[model samples]
Target: MLSESSRPIIESTLQTIAERINDITVIFYRKMFEYHPELMDGMFSRADQAEGIQPRALAGSVPVFASYILANPDSYPDEMLARIAHKHASLGVTADQYEIVYKYLFAAIAENLGDACTPEIAEAWTEVYWLMADVLVKIEKGLYDGQKNDVIHSNFKLVSRKEAGTSVLDMIFEPADSTVMSDAVAGQYVTVIVKTEDGLRQPRQYTLLPSAQNQRRIAVKQNEDGEVSPMLHKLEVGDIIEISNPYGDVVLGGYSDQDSQPLYLFSAGIGIVPMVAFLAELKKNHSKRSVVAVHADSSSEAWPLREEYLKLVAELDDAKAISFLKDGEGDFQGEVRVESLDMPRLASVYMCGPLSYMQSVRSALVQQGIPGRNIQYEIFGPDQWILRATRRSMRGNRV
Candidate 1:
C-alpha cells in the first residue's frame, strides 16, 4: 500500500520518472557497485550488467510497482510480485539488500532529478519505495521458507553429464555433502554459481529438468556471449557447482483440475525446458487429458531435449507433439505459425520463450478465441514482461 501523500506525488511525476527511470537505475547500479564491489562477485550477473539489461529491467519494475499500488490501493499485482519474488528467492536476494538498493537508488533519483526533487517529493517517493520493498520482502521470505533448505546456495556435485544437443549440456548433480539439502519440484529453476575464467563467480538460472529423487538435472545452453553458460558447458561428470534450491511459481501442469479440458504447451528454442518437465509428469501419471505440445527450433537436431519430450508425449494416450523449424520440415515449417495452430476446446495454454515470441503467441491465442486469462508464460530473465506488454500496447494503439 502507498501513503495518500505518495500516491498523488507518484502519479503526477510517473511519466517523467518512467522516461528517465533507465538512466536512474543505471546510475544506481553503477554507484552501488562502485561502493559495494562485492555485489559484482556473486549477487548480480556481470553479463546482464554489462549488457545493461538488468538495470533497465529493474528500472521498469520499480515504477510499475509504484503505479500499481497507487492505482489499486488495496490489492497489489500478484502476478508481477510472484515473478519478482521467485527470481529474488532463486538468486538468494536478502531483505537487507533492499536497503542497500534504496540508499543508492534514491541518491540516483535525487541527483538525476536535480532542483525538482523537493523534500516533499523525496519523502513521498521514499514511502513508495519502502512500501513496494516491504511487500517484496514478505513475499520473498515466504518463498525462501517454503524451500527444502533455508540457506541460499548448497553444494551440488555433478553425478552425470551428457551432450543433450548442439550447444547444450545435460548436467545432473547430487548433494555434495550430508549437510546440503537436495530437492526440486518440476517447473522450478536452480541458479548455478560458476567460477568464470577470470575467477569471477557468475550466477545463472537453468530450469530443473526431470531426474532422480536425490539428484537435480539442468540443461545448459551455451550462450557464446554469456559468461556462465559457456563455463558450464565445459564441466565434467565429477565437477561440483553451487546450485540454489529450485524456486519458481510457474508450477508446470497446474492449469486446470478437470481432465476433459485440453492442455497446450508451447515453446521456442531452449524455452522447452520447463515444458519438458511438465510433460514428464503428465506421462508418469498416464494423464488422459488432451495435451498438445508445440516446439519451435532452428532445426530438429538443434532442439534440446527433443527426444525426451517427444517420448513423454508419445507415452500419453491423449497427447501429441508438434515441431516447427526454420531449417525445413515439421508439423509447421518456417517460423512458429501461431496463426495456423489448431485451437483446442477451452485449452489451458502455457508458453515459454523470448518475450516477443510469447507476445505473438498470446495475441494469436486471443484471436483464436482463447481467453487471455487462460494463458500463462514464464520468462528466463528479469520480470519486465509487464512493462514490455505495456510498451507494446501503447505502440499498437499509436497507429
Candidate 2:
C-alpha cells in the first residue's frame, strides 16, 4: 500500500500522469535503448519497439497498477502481474535488469513530470515501482524453480518441419542436449530464440501443441518482413535453435478436467494456438465436457493447424467446431456472428485473438446472460483489451 502522504498527490496528479504516461514510456524506451544498446540486440523485440506496442503496454500498466493499489488499500493485480512476469521470464528477464529499467524509468518520469514533480512524489512512485518489481521478481523466480531445468537458453533440434496451412510452418523439435522436457500444461507457451541472419538473436513466444514429453511442436506464421520467423522458416530438419522452458499460466483442466460444463474456446487468426492446445489436453484425457471451438480467419487455407484441429475436435466425445472466414471455401464463410451461436448456460468461456474480435465476442456473450466473470481471454501480445473491457464494466458504461 502507498503511504498516506503519497495518496493525495497521486490522486491529484493522476490525470496529468495518465495523460503523459505515453510520452514518458516512449521517451523511457528510446533513452534506455540509447544507453543500453545490448537490450535491443535480443532481449527486446525491435519490431515491437518500433511499432510502439511495448511502450503503450508499459504506459497502460503503470497507471493501472497505481490506480488499483490506490483504490484497493490491500489487494494487488495478480493476473496482470503474473502475465507480465511470465512474459518477462519468457524473455529471460533477470532481477538485476529491473535496476536498469528503474534508472531510465525514473529519469523519464522526472523529465516528463517536470515542475509537477517533487521529491516526495518521486519517492512514492519509486516505492510503487519497486513493490511491483519485487513481486515480479519473486513470481518469476518461483516459475523458474518449478521448471524441469533452470536453463534459460537450451538447444532444441528441429526434428521435422511441414506446412500446417498457408504461410504456416508446423515445426517439431526434440531436445538437442541431455535436458529432459518438462510436461507443460495446455495453454503454455515457449520462447523460441533464433539467431537471425543479421547475427542478432531474437525471441518470439509460441504456444505449445500437445506432444510427447521429449518433443515440442510450434506452428510459426511466416512474416514477410519478420526478423526471426523468416529465418526460422529457412532452417531444415537437422537445424537447431534455442527454446525456453514451457511457461504460461493460461491453463485449462488444471483442477477439473472432468467438468461437464460447456467449455467455449474462441479464436481468431493465430489465436487458435491456445485453443488447439486446450483441445489437445482435453482429447488426451478423453474429456466428456461439452466443447465449442469457434474460429475465424481470412480463408480456410489461411487457418493454421486447421486439419489438426478438425481431427482433434472430431475426436472429442462432445465437441463441435465452427469457423468463419471472409473468403472461405466449402464451409465457414463470411464474418463471425457471435450472437448466432446456440448459447450455453453457465459456460466457461476462453478467448484469444485480435483485440476487437475478443471484445466483440465477449460483449455478445455478456449480453446473452453469460456472466462477465466466466469469460477468460488471452492476448497474443501485451494485454490492452482486458483492461479496457474491465474498466468499461467497472464504470457501468455501455461499450
Which predicted model would earn the best lDDT? 2
Residues 360-398, candidate 2: write the lDDT tens digits.
888788888899878887877666664554354435321
- Tell me the tens digit of each residue's lDDT in model 1 across 1-399: 677667678878888888999889878988999999988877788878887888887767777766666556677767777787888888889989999999999999999999999998889888878877898899998887876667788788888888887898888898887655646667888888999888878888888898877888998888897778878888887888888888887875454436566889999888999999998878777677888999988888888888888999988888888888888867778777776767864778889988878988888888888976678888877657766654443343321
What overall lDDT, based on C-alpha atoms, would model 1 receive against the true structure? 0.81
TM-score of each: 0.94, 0.94
Kindly report which residue stretches of model 1 are placed more than 4 angstroms away from their true locations once superposed. Answer: 180-182, 253-259, 390-399
Each candidate: RMSD to true structure? 2.7, 2.4
> 258 in model 1: Cα distance from truth in Å?
1.8
Question: Lowest-lDDT window of 10 residues in candidate 2?
Answer: 390-399
Q: How far is candidate 1 from the true structure (C-alpha RMSD, Å)?
A: 2.7
Each model's backbone clash number: 0, 0
Candidate 2: pairs in clash? none
